[model samples]
Target: MAGIYLHIPFCKKACHYCDFHFSTSLKNKEPLLKALAQEIILRADEFKDKIVETIYFGGGTPSILAVDEIKNIIKMLRENYEVIQVPEITLEANPDDLTDDKIKELAQTEINRLSIGVQSFGEKELQMMNRAHNAQEVKQCLQTATQYFDNITIDLMYGIPGLSNQEWKQNIQQALDFGISHISSYALTVEEGTALADFIKKGKYPAVDESLAAQHFDILVELLTQSGFDHYEISNFGKPNAYSKHNTSYWLGKSYLGFGPSAHSFNGDIRSWNVANNTKYIKSLSENQLPSTQEILTIKDRYNEYIMTGLRTIWGVSLNKISKDFGLETSAFLEKQVEPFLANGTLVLKQNQLKTTQKGKFLADGIASELFWV
Candidate 1:
């Protein structure tokens, strides 16, 4: 189908605002990678009839692995699945890990895209987030990575407590200066268990300002749009032909298999995720058992997922599909539900597709939740 996602659950250090499942310790790395490979082989039967179009290496820091380790995983995938001739293989990497030598070696692998985590170009922002990479490393990695790969996307964060609108613009400009084709920009959110949240609670750090974040988001969209980049998804921007195929598949509701601890997978109806604990995931897979829990989605669940994703993308929700799949009752209910939004200029209906207006872009998730079939 659309892709396979491998979660490399190891990071050099934890970012202050992240809540994703990852371990900073490398002690279980070898076992984890081995288990990751095993899990891929074990799940091959699940999608035997499907041809994979993309392979995404996500996570704690996929760049933390050596080139050979990365290669071995790709090798296992090749042995197990029917990957397309030129799959959109992506590696989520950090700046410090992508040395000149490392980039050279990665260029030789099947990986054709790099999604680098360069949270911000400002040293204060980087330090504030406790990101492993420094300002200089961000610049260095981009310059060197461009030399080797043309398809590159960088992650940028905005709305930090001390960051100003001007500094936010500068961060976007820095990415543009590198000729970066794709950008995944996000506002700094303090997840409940993250260090940032705890710090804010303890009065050691300031809380995130929603108005400030909205300002940053507006600037980002305006700047990137003027630079000839398409605002493909709410948090993603890309030049022509540079959008992330793997992630696009997700927004479009295509099935993909995720390997490694805390990874998720979905078929048309069933959604599953591996255990978040590294040791438990490895132990189960070692015993030839899948370490995952799954649920068969109900009609209401599917409709809600579509509404959540569709409104966030350039391609909005299709009323016709809703009618056909969930029947006219659901479609009519949705049409009725959207009356307030349509009248307020926050939504538009065109060719049977319900889309978010620019004013509603930042509030897509909220809008989707309100529209869900409760």
Candidate 2:
């Protein structure tokens, strides 16, 4: 099965730590929507023989659009693609846009999931992140959203400079209180060229502390797992059978088509990404051409990718699958490489699947990189 990702590259304001491609201006809004629809139709042939299982509306900020605009886009995809019956359609939204009325409107659409961008529930953290929604809006949005969407997930961030563990605990508790089924949490990082990075460079803000982030990660896993949420992926927690099928497909190496500016697509081997420029993306599609670049992933590239993605999930890396696909030598190499982590009790081999132990999870990325087929 395959999935479709449509990027809506417009936002009301830029978050201080965000570097995703987007424009605050709505000047090209009409053209962009047209281009997005056109691109979807243009790429429909690629997935013509593939069953489309998921449709994800990701962004700049997907909620920035009106209900009709979203409906039109979903309608276009359904008309052009061989979408499965009762496909999982998700829309990423900001809390500010999800008023009670808006939430009610969204529930009537084909969209069945809401991935709200409630980065933090604390007023201080909200202001620090330059989020469009305040603590009150966050609460109000969740209260209303839970009424409509059962498959709801909220984004949460940790490791803010002044956010104490007590505050973080409170944040986790608040989400639980709302009965959100999924939680995708991440430790805030400073990306270069973002306002947060500049602030740190100019000594206007404190640099992110990794040690503190580690502490928060521990707290997050402990609390969520105790609450009966599965830490299925390093950055995601979901109740049983409520994991994000779209994202889980990515980790499992499924093919997907990504449309609009700055979106990426994969076809089991080759991976491609569209230009980040909206004007260029629209202009190219106006001429019925794709404005994207692609690369054919080598065997090593594929193996390394599987290793990186597999190690981060509870499914883990399958030794037998590696041996069958990458040959005995490569499999032997992996087994040797994994020894250090296994010996340290950071990794465990269970039923031929190598998975991270609680001690190794926070360091999964680093460990995966070391075992890369360099």
Candidate 3:
């Protein structure tokens, strides 16, 4: 099965720490939407025979669009692709954009999942991140959202410089109280060229505390697990039936087509990404060209990718699969490298799947990099 990702590169405002490709202008939105629809039709043949199981509308702020626009895009995809029945169609939305009327309209479409960006329920943290939604809006949006969507996931962030541990707990508690089925919590990092980075460079804001971040991550695992949520990925927790199918397919090395500006697509070997500039993207597409770059993955590149993606999830890396796909020598090399983490109790080999232990999860990226082939 394959999935599809459509990037909507427009946001109401830039977040303090965001690094994703997006524009603050709506001047080109109409053209961008048309280009995206054209892209869907143009790329339909790419994944022709594969069953489309998931379609994700992600971006700067997918919720910012009008309900009719979202419906039109979905309609276009359906006309062009063999989209599966009951596909996991998710739209990433900001809390401010979720109104009762919008939620009702969303329910009428084929979209079945809502991934709300409710970074924090604390007013102070929300303002610090320059988020448009207030604490009350998050509560209201989730309340209204649950009325229409059962497969709901909320995005959250921890490790804000001024956010306290108690506040962090409250964020998770809020998701639980709202009965949100999935939580995608991430540690706030100061990306270069972002407003937060500039503030830090000017001594106006302090750098994020790495130790505090790690402490919060530990708390996240303990609390979410106790709440009966699967700490499935390092940054994601889901109730038994709520795991994100689109993201899971990516981790499992499934092929997917990505449309619109800055979207990336992977076909198990070659990977490609569209241009980040919205104006250029629309111009190129208007000229009947897809503004994108492509790369053919070498064996080592594929192995490294597998290490990165597989190690970050509960499914982990399969020794036999690695041996069969990458050969015995490569598998032996990985086994030897993984021995230290295994002995340190940071990783465990269970049922031939090597997964990280709770204590080792915080350092997952480092461990995966260590196992990477040259």
| TM-score of structure candidate 1 | 0.99
Give candidate 3's whole-model lDDT: 0.92
Better of 1 and 3 by lDDT: 1
**How do the residues 1-374 of candidate 1 rate in per-residue lDDT, one tens digit apiece?**
66899999989999999999999999999898888888998899998999999999998899999999999998899899998889999999999999999999999999999999999999999898898989999999899999999999999988888899999999999999999999998988879988988999999998899999999999999999999999989999999889999999999999999999999999879999999999999999899999999999999999999999999999999998999999999998999999999999989999999999989999999999999999
Q: For residue 11, give model 2's deviation from the true position in Å.
A: 0.7
Error of 2 at 244 (Å): 0.4
Ranking by lDDT: 2, 1, 3
The local lDDT score (0 to 100) that residue 108 gets in candidate 3 is: 91
- Model 3 ranges with Cα > 4 A deviation: none
For candidate 2, list the clashing residue pairs, or say none: none
Superior by lDDT: candidate 1 or candidate 2: 2
